[model samples]
Target: MFKMKEKWRYLKTEDKTAYANMAIDRAVLVANSECKVSPTVRFFTWNPPAISIGYFQSLEDEVNLEMCKNIGVDYVRRITGGGAVYHESELTYSIVIPESHPQVPKNIMESYGRICGAVIKGLKNLGINSNYIPVNDIIADGKKISGNAQTRKLKTVLQHGTILTDVDVNKMFLLLKVPDEKIKDKLIADVKQRVTSIKHILGDDINFNETAKAMKAGFEEEFNVDLVEGQLTSYEKELAKRFEIEFFGSKQWNHRR
Candidate 1:
């Protein structure tokens, strides 16, 4: 009875660097708003792992540059504002839709609820019982497994989140600063208690493709739409390339805030 747009591009991409990852999201948002592309559901992963901070968060306060460089973890600042996320062993999804779409919620908070519910449904598809923690997070059995960030620009809404397949608390604490060594140990312990991953819950090293498939079904069931397999156009690819070189990868942009 509540049928809306059924056609949505499903772009399941390969693992990429932090720069390229951020770029693709921006490309989709811009292209869709300009009517150059259709609404899309993108799933991707990070190669070499990466740390992405919110647009408003301070890079210095949130991440340790030396640790990142020493450990070879890519880092960038996202256009969407939220907390930092360590993109490692995770399935990341990005949803791009026109702000004026009849089915899409107009209010920001309501929009987050709508989108995050789809993510919750996705986890359910994996047989992982998780609850939406509101504002922008999903917790599985009292431990967080997914975190999302969103932004609206050029009349388009872009919401992206990470469904962690595995979490390296030792590695994460190294990248994110706490305080003293004692605090660092306590922080790691606290994080281990708070954050969780699919691998941990399933008790196996489940492939990301498997998780991606579950996500597809989850969003489909939750949103009542089909995810038509699609590819990126030349325009978005070109823009992503430019963004990689100029925006995401550039120190000026990464350290600006």
Candidate 2:
């Protein structure tokens, strides 16, 4: 005799500032670890065009704050470490699982690979032939369509990534700093060549909602679990607010070395 596995919570949240979004993800991670909520598959959007630097990134080095201000772009630091990402017209998803979950791997790289594999599967469900490229990226036709980051906290593993509905290389370059001006043109060209989007691949027939549906199906199938729609608990919301005030919204936290 065997027991049936539990279903995952599917959190469909509205667009929010970069700060609130990251704070919520961290709060969910903590809540799940403390047995407050079921493991979650959260999908969200960024309201204004935003820039998020990796937790360990030097904001001064990677981002041009003046440019962000001039363009009215929101910015925040993520708890999970990764390269800087400009959030414009993209869909973001986060998965929170207890560290002891059977699906999670003990090895860090293996954990990354496991999450990226689910992402690849999600892209595939969207009609894109995407593949997990070793670490934390999902590529299609040799160009990156998705990039992910992971972190562990309170005995839980949280992984999040973005699926570009469309890529704005020019805008992205405006926010992220390039070391050499001489090679700036070349760098932009190289980036355009290396990154892709769902709209680019599937044309106008596909959209954000459709892409999200595909990803939801992909994760459910990949993990062999169901996605039951849910919302953040009051405790998680309060914790997120504290995180926003103390960390995501604070210059000290964003610029901390």
Q: Pick the candidate with the highest TM-score.
A: 2
lDDT of 2 by residue, 1-257 (tens): 88686799999876799989989998998889989899899888998779998989899999999999999998899998989999988889999999899988988889988887777788888778988886788889889989999999888999999988898999999989999978999999999999999888887546567777888988887888989887899999999999999999898988895
* Backbone clashes under 3 angstroms, per model: 0, 0
lDDT of 2: 0.89
Each model's lDDT: 0.90, 0.89
Candidate 1 lDDT tens digits, 116-145: 988888889888999988789889989999
> Clashing residue pairs, candidate 2?
none
What are the TM-scores, per candidate, against the unseen true structure?
A: 0.96, 0.97
In candidate 2, stretches whose alpha carbon ends up further than 4 angstroms from where it belongs are 2-5
With a 3 Å backbone cut-off (N, CA, C), the pairs that clash in candidate 1 are: none
Q: Please state the error at residue 233 of candidate 1 in Å.
A: 0.1
**Residue 32 accuracy (lDDT) in model 1:** 94
Prediction 2 TM-score vs. true: 0.97
Give residue 96's lDDT in candidate 1 (0 to 100): 95
